[model samples]
Target: MKKKIVALTAIAVLSVGTAAQAAASSVHTVQSGDTLWSISKDNNVSVEELQAWNELDSTLIYPSQDLKVEDKVETYVVVKGDSLYKIATKHNISVDDLMNWNNISSDLIFPGEEFVLQGTKASTTNKTAQKATAPVSAPASAPVQKAPSAPVAVKAPASSTAGKEMTVTATAYTAYCAGCSGTTATGIDLRANPNQKVIAVDPSVIPLGSRVWVEGYGEAIAGDTGGAIKGNIIDLFMENKQDALNWGRQTVTIKILD
Candidate 1:
């Protein structure tokens, strides 16, 4: 009958639609002798990524298990007090990577905006391959001569006044100073992370743990406090005494990014 034919045609269309949806999501079945590292190698992904995508606490797997081999698009929603640097630091990723993943050319990002956390697998694999194939320098038998220090031109990051901006008198200090514990008041270990960008601020003026953009200094975290760092005065952190001395004192503009 015509009615029976119509019902069978509708059922066939629904079955085909379901099959297409399943095929779109790439899933790999775990077989005997399979490991996370081996599966990652076969799929052109990293073992860390495998664990993250599957939300697996460990590398243990059994036969006939299903694993998601496709790259999962992870995203983060910007909050009231969030900056690219802050979010990248929290996620243990670079700010450049974060910006590139989101196709962001500027540092300006608004609250409630969503940003992608990961790039495509091809990009990630290419970066890893480049690192692995990089040429290593041969060890020098003789003492290498030190080059003369040149005046390096530092490029400041793009300016943004998304939050409060203030002109503050800035001074530089090193963590290796005499009698210094190399720890900030906010519990950031400067000695352990000499490259970490941090600045001492008056908690009343710039709240601790705030992401601030300092003029000529780029982005930094307000993670320290000083006895003399009162009012509009801020102390920038440097890795070495020479760098601190070079920075000396300057009047700079600071924007509280978050």
Candidate 2:
């Protein structure tokens, strides 16, 4: 009976150890020549999963940077003054995922509400499969055009009313900038459409979603905003980082066209 009791105790201890090991978080340290794709492949996880877990805005990673690779279900209770974006940033997850996991269409959330942080593997797999099988085609309503190699000189729509004209200090920016998610404030995917004519401006000065004509950079949609872009400051979007570097900083005239 004593031997049997000792054996049972050992089994119980082993079970607890196994459970703890399964629940432990996994991390991967970036090495030279390491890419998110390679790391995700090696870890049997998707690249999106890695990005969500690490809260990476871009695919860029550096040597010795630690990344969370494990996907574990977590529940978060909303506190006072909590927003979806805030909660998502805090948990290193995407706002879209947060809404999808909780089946909420709107961003509105009340205090004490619970939200799932991680998506189920089966759902992710299904999405991947669906994407793989879907047909790829641009919408006929809005035809796709090849973007110009350089900013082209264009006039604003003749029908639209001209708004305020201001001479602002302008700087260039790219989608690959550090901590940049390649997404604009108005939901323009810069990384996917690098050649899209867009610029960041202070919405108070130049309203967002307005067409603006930059003195030298041609006409672009004022579709983005930045923390540093305040008052008389604007940021031009460039497809190439070298082009952005070449632009540097300059004072330019901009006319907002509605």
Candidate 3:
């Protein structure tokens, strides 16, 4: 009778221990001293459950072997006013770097769109890239502030009217010319606003006061016109003569905004 009583107590204890192990069982890497049973007990999982998750025929495991932990994923939903600049600013990263990170083509983004803030399962499947590091624009405590003296990022509110969309041969030019008034058609002082993005387009092709997106270049103000700029030809104003020469000529997509 005493033996039977002890047997019942042992069964109850074993049942409780199994439940505890099952509760904590998810996925864990086999550390140096880790065995299949120890891993299952620590994570509150069964050895068979771990085997099933890892598709292992036996309990044999090795260090650094990745096992399924959780199916949870991380993502971000785009809000109404979320621009690349704003989102990147929030994440403390650069606009160009963000574009590269997400493989984003243009600044255009819609609400409710999802982006992977963290890595996916495939990225973690390999032991090499255990965690993906998001680029840090700066330290977390300090807010990212642009220098007032530096040129703007060129992402301005575009005009309402998208008058035309075309492929044009764009050539760069400097403010200093042989016999030129160092001023734009719209009277923007380039000598003063040297870094300000300004482009020269034929008034007939793209009217003055128009905003445009030039491929390979950011947005620019169509505040200038050039004698040579006519029809499909556009003159992109560079800050210096060297810049003009560097961007000799290229066929670029132009989005003509109001």
- Please list the Cα RMSD from the true structure of every candidate, rounded to 1 decimal place: 21.7, 22.2, 29.0
Off by over 4 Å in 1: 1-162
The TM-score ranking, best first, is 1, 3, 2
Tell me, by TM-score, which candidate is best: 1
Backbone collisions counted per model: 0, 0, 8
What is the TM-score (0 to 1) of candidate 2?
A: 0.39
* Deviation from native of the Cα of residue 73 in model 3, angstroms: 35
Instruction: Give me the runs in candidate 2 sitting further than 4 Å from their true place.
Output: 1-161
TM-score of predicted structure 1: 0.42
List TM-score per model, in order: 0.42, 0.39, 0.41
Residue-level error in angstroms, candidate 1, position 76: 12
> Which tens-of-lDDT digit does each residue in 16-135 have in candidate 3?
122211333344555554455445433433445556778889656676676654232233334334566777666665765545434455555554343433322112111111123232
Whole-model lDDT, model 3 = 0.53
**Model 3: which residue pairs collide?**
21-44, 21-45, 22-44, 24-43, 24-44, 25-43, 25-44, 25-45
